[model samples]
Target: MATAGPTPFDPAAEFDRQVRTLTELGYPKLSGLAPERFAALLEPLRATALTAVAGEAAGEYDPESGRVPFVLVVTRELAPIEETMSRTTLHGGKLPGFVDRSFEPGALERFVATPEARHPGRHAYLILEVERGEEFCGSVPLDAMATIAGRGRSLLTIEEGVALITHFPQVLVKNKCFSLGGSRSGDRRVPAIWISQKAPKLGWCWEGNPHTWLGMASAGDRRATAGSSGS
Candidate 1:
């Protein structure tokens, strides 16, 4: 069986698509900005989009490591980053884009520079998929990962982490760690902050999002007190 070659990319179209996504993510404060200003803000992104990176699998999934180690973050919510990196045909796109390229070995360094580039906020967890071995799901900040790498504690390089992210497998939305709704209405929606919750296994699902700011504050205080007293 002959395999198909990579598709071509259109820079003009891909630039427009990315701008639209940023709008949905509530960026640029468009209402107050002049058209020229808004367009100017996007010039760098537009320029970056001119080049396309093809997506390819980069890391080996360890059969022995059942835990997400950091996380098995679902691909959808975390996908905008990948999409911003390459056309959907590459892997994470819902629609096609102009570029037919994949991330090269050092691609993460560039992807991190995109204007709206952000690391997805996901809980640290221990996942038991039953069919698969234990998957450790947690993430330290990028700086933390860098620090670890610099210390030579991890055989995995920062570039390797970027490769893992770029070519992460299509994941299932396994669980929710936070939610919000109006007091009178039962409308659950994404919240602004996930807040820290450390626990064994599924932290988000078990601890849940605290309902009130005061409640969260109290928890923080208690944790602080415990740390101080124990010391």
Candidate 2:
């Protein structure tokens, strides 16, 4: 055969690859923690996210293999993504670069940062997936949401932000884009989580917020979209 052309990127595979690196890196304290409690806390987040995603559409959230990957749109070019997942910070998991480390040696009964989170620093990538509505976002400023909407987009919550930080610390927010007329306004922005490379060990915070870019159009812009329903 002749020379092969380039191929498109596989989001799922690429996501898994990124996650694999962390797993390989290893969470020093993962083995020591109570698997039951850790699994229990994680389950609720997964359930709620899955339910919210499923309520909107099928295949939005995947639980088959526990990949739990989300789309991360980069509003800006190569926004810094996190690489480490730390426990709670001084302000309750609201600090940069995994500052207030909390391995919680015996606090398994309560909750402490995993050893994996104690890592010094990591690289990150800012990714984005099209979101549905304003169900996940509770911390985002209400006024900001309205202003952004006027620019041809809407604001959603960063549900995955916590999980992303807790696990990968690479992604920022689990945001969404409005399907109404397929927003294509160049000025529109959507916050997203970034994959990391050599960034600091930024534990978790609301600063990594990303914005959507080039508009959120599926087929065309400013046009009504229709779908068929079951009989």
The best candidate by lDDT is 2
lDDT of 2 by residue, 67-148 (tens): 2334222111111122233431221235543322332232212222122111111212222333333232332333444444
Worst 10 residues of 2 by lDDT: 217-226
Model 2, residue 55: distance off in Å is 3.7
The alpha-carbon root-mean-square deviation between model 2 and the true structure, to one decimal in Å, is 15.5
Displacement of the residue 177 alpha carbon in candidate 1, Å? 8.9
lDDT of 1 by residue, 10-98 (tens): 44454464455444533334234454555554454333223221121122233122112121111122234334323212223343222
Assess candidate 2 and give its TM-score to the true structure: 0.27
lDDT of 2: 0.28
Q: Which candidate number maximizes TM-score?
A: 2
Distance from true location, Cα of 156 in model 2, Å = 10
Q: After superposition, how far is residue 169 of candidate 2 from its true place, in Å?
A: 6.5
Superposed model 2: Cα runs more than 4 Å off: 1-32, 56-197, 200-231
TM for every model, in the order presented, reads: 0.26, 0.27
